[model samples]
Target chain A: MSTSAAERAVNYVILIVFAAFALAPIVTVLAAALSPQSGAESAGLAGLHPGNFVDAWSEGEFSRYLRTSVLVAVTVVSVAVIASILSGFAFGTMRFGGSRVLFYLFLLGIMVPAEAIVVPLFYDLREVGLTNTLWAVALPQIAQSIAFGTYWMRAYFRTSPPSLIEAATLDGASPRRVLWSILVPIGRPAVMTLTVLAFMWTWNEFLIPLVMSPNGDFRTAPLALAIFKGQHVQATALLAAAAVLVALPVVIVYLFAQRHFIRGMLEGAVRE
Target chain B: MRHQRRYLPYLYLTPALLLFGTFLLYPLVRSAQFSLFSWDGLGASEFVGFDNYVELFTDEVLRAAFGHALVLILFFSVLPLGLGLVIAAILNRGQVRGLGLFRTVVFLPQVLAMVVVAVAWRQIYAPNGTLNTALRAVGLDELTRTWLGDYTWTLPAVGMVGTWVQTGLVTVLLLAGMGRVPRDLFEAARLDGAGAVREFFAITLPSVRGEIAVALTLTIVAALKTFDLVYVTTGGGPGNSTTVPAYEVFQRAFREGAVGSAAAIAIALTAIIFVLNVIVNRIAEGREE
Candidate 1:
């Protein structure tokens, strides 16, 4: 099982090449964002400069979109985590008639692509006079996220020893207390992982917001960037700049929580 | 005591059940009902029975969109799965240093908004963009073409971007699956005089079959429902060449004001996805058995 020098060399070369191919587009976009000139003409990797970033930021209304995106993402994650915790604990610990059937029904939400229901969702929201509001976007996303979040936390909680819950009950701890004290604390890593995923998905979601809020004022960062590109079609530098701005937060979150993000997604994949 | 405990579980599940009924179940039923009616999403819905479904079946545009979606499955599902398995095999060899760095770099695309990925790739595929420049620099100018605009290449070309974005996800999943593969089995094979390639096929591939199936199912689902990538890149341009079911739904509902027809398309898509899911799950279950 000892490694050979030739094998090690080959591995390094393969890793380098694959890594470059993976990272190239991101690096290219970042470089383009920094380019000075803002036009349709070819920049050829030479026009890159810092000044384009400033222009992209100021001209694109990126700050407002970033704020809206943050608000939506945070709210969705917060609500989803709380709801998933309650539901996951409920499904995991409690035993009731038809619980298995109900849990399976919830799994349908995961299988049915969001795009399928978006039309009806739009009409429902509009009928309720909630269109163009942040809740319209946040509510559906939270609803969509709950299935996976519940499934995730249910797995985590099921694996957790039931003795702890029984002990908490024996100590006269209320059901709510048992969850907050016994479950939430122990499930912190899974909770954090879910939060990161929820945030990433909500922040990057495009179609729902784009269709729900066509007005310029309510646009999220991703939608705004899409619109910005269309409006400034001839401005490649600025478009790249705008794209970088939109992508930065998710990239930062990913870098810091890379392990959790990957693990959470992989866990979801295998379990389902 | 068992009965009391069982009731307690349902009590706990009440909130999820309520939400699922209201949001998930309700909308799905409502959509089915709506598909039988003609409405502009704002006006009175006139129920017309199965007319919408009949029209959708005959609609050339809808048929083409499904065709494009099938094409996208090749790009988004088949290619990514193949390339990602190779990458995962390479990384799983245990000789790669800076594994964390490589994984992050590969998964970077998954984190970015599809809007950003589409836009960035659009730039790269532009007439005189970086891809073309690189092609020319390497004396492949003759091979250079308007990748995103070309009718023949547009769907596959866009699907390639999807492949690029998702390959990292497949690789990461397969790597995790590969980790579960016992090193002893590999060693035993090696001792039997099996080469690396032989060992991989005999030991590694079988071990990760579940992961492969899972990855393929997820990628195929994503491919079939692909919209944002096409929306941002081509907007189903060059004469509806890249249009897919999702885009068709968007167009029919929003652009064409045919909510009933759009709902029918949505229903059809749901049916397709459901059948696919059942088939995959059955296959996975059969394999496990």
Candidate 2:
């Protein structure tokens, strides 16, 4: 496996080039968002400025969109985490007939792409008078998150030492109490990883909200940015600013939970 | 107590089952039923039987969409998986400084909204954008053309963006897989006079087979359902050159009011995905056994 210095230099060069290509577009948008003018015709490296951000904020209705996005993502993540913990504990710890079958059935949700179901989901939601409501967005996402969250927490619980659960059971802890007091306390890392992932995904989701609630009132950040793109195709600087605003939450989440994100991805890939 | 124990598993599964049936399973069946009848979002339905499926097979536009998806599979799945493995290997060897920063930068695209990625890349691929400018600067002016707007190259160009966004995920997955390879295996190879390339093919590649399979499956699935990027960047335009199956489905159901046709397309796409998944899982299982 030994390599000469020249070969090593070549390897580094390749890595650097690939990294640059990977990051170029994102960096370009950040630059665009900071630029001055608000038209694609005038946009370029020379037009780069920060003043367009203020204009974009007002014109894109980004503040309101941001509020909606945060509310939806937080609610989805919170509900998903709690529901998953309960279900994961029950499936992982309690032995009963059809447990494995039911678990696999739940995993089937992973394969059912949202695109395939949007039509019916739209009709069903409209029937319930839930269309254009935040509940429409949050409920579906919570449903989707349960599959992965349950799978993840189940993995976490299976790997946990049995002595703890047994000890809790012997101490007169009910199944619910054991989950709340014993399992959840030890499942913090897995919970945090799931939370970060769920938050990022729910925040970035576009199609669900787009079809479920197209009204400007219920528009999430990504949907808002999309609508902004359609209406303001000529407003390049403002679009860039809105794009940056849309990306900010994910960027911040990555900065704080980069390691956990990596861990979560790796863990999911390896296990499945 | 025995009866309680017997019901406990169902109890545990009730929440997931309810959600899955309502959201995932029910929609799947309903969409299938919808595919047998013609209806708009607001109007009366008429049973059209298998006409929708037949039309999907015969329609030139739908055929082109499938073709585009196949092309995208090359850019999104095949190329990304190959290049990602190379990048992951180099990073694993400690050949690059600031490895953590590099990993973070590469993975940044996966977190960004597709709309944002599309907007940024669309600018870069514009007629007088960075790509063309770079080509001209390198004395390759003749090669310079509108990257996205051009009919012949639009699909490939869009696929390339997909490759960029996805390579990071593939690289990180492979890198994690590589970490699981025993360091002593490489040390042993070096002692036996194995060179870098030989060691990679023999020691590194074989050891990370599971990861390669995982990366391939993920990238393949992502490629098949690619919509947002294409929708934002091209709208499957320039005579539908960049149209993919998912985009076609969206256009039919929403824009064209062809609900039955769209559902048929979705069911067909799902079948294709399911078959691929089974094939991949079987290969992985075979390797394990």
TM-scores of chain A in all candidate models: 0.94, 0.92
> Candidate 2: which docking quality band?
medium
User: Candidate 2: deviation at residue B240, Å?
Assistant: 1.3
Q: What is the DockQ (computed on Cα atoms) for candidate 2?
A: 0.57
Tens digits of per-residue lDDT for model 1, A142-163: 8878878888889888888888
lDDT of 1 by residue, B78-189 (tens): 8888888777876677566798788888888888899999888988899988899999999998989999888898887898898888888888888888988888887888
lDDT of 2 by residue, B115-169 (tens): 8888888878878777898899999999999787788888889999889988988
In candidate 1, list every pair of residues with a backbone clash.
A34-A49, A35-A48, A35-A49, A94-B9, A95-B6, A95-B9
Q: Which candidate is the best by lDDT?
A: 1
Q: Per-prediction DockQ scores?
A: 0.61, 0.57
The 10-residue segment of model 1 chain B with minimum total lDDT is B1-10
lDDT of 1 at B151: 83
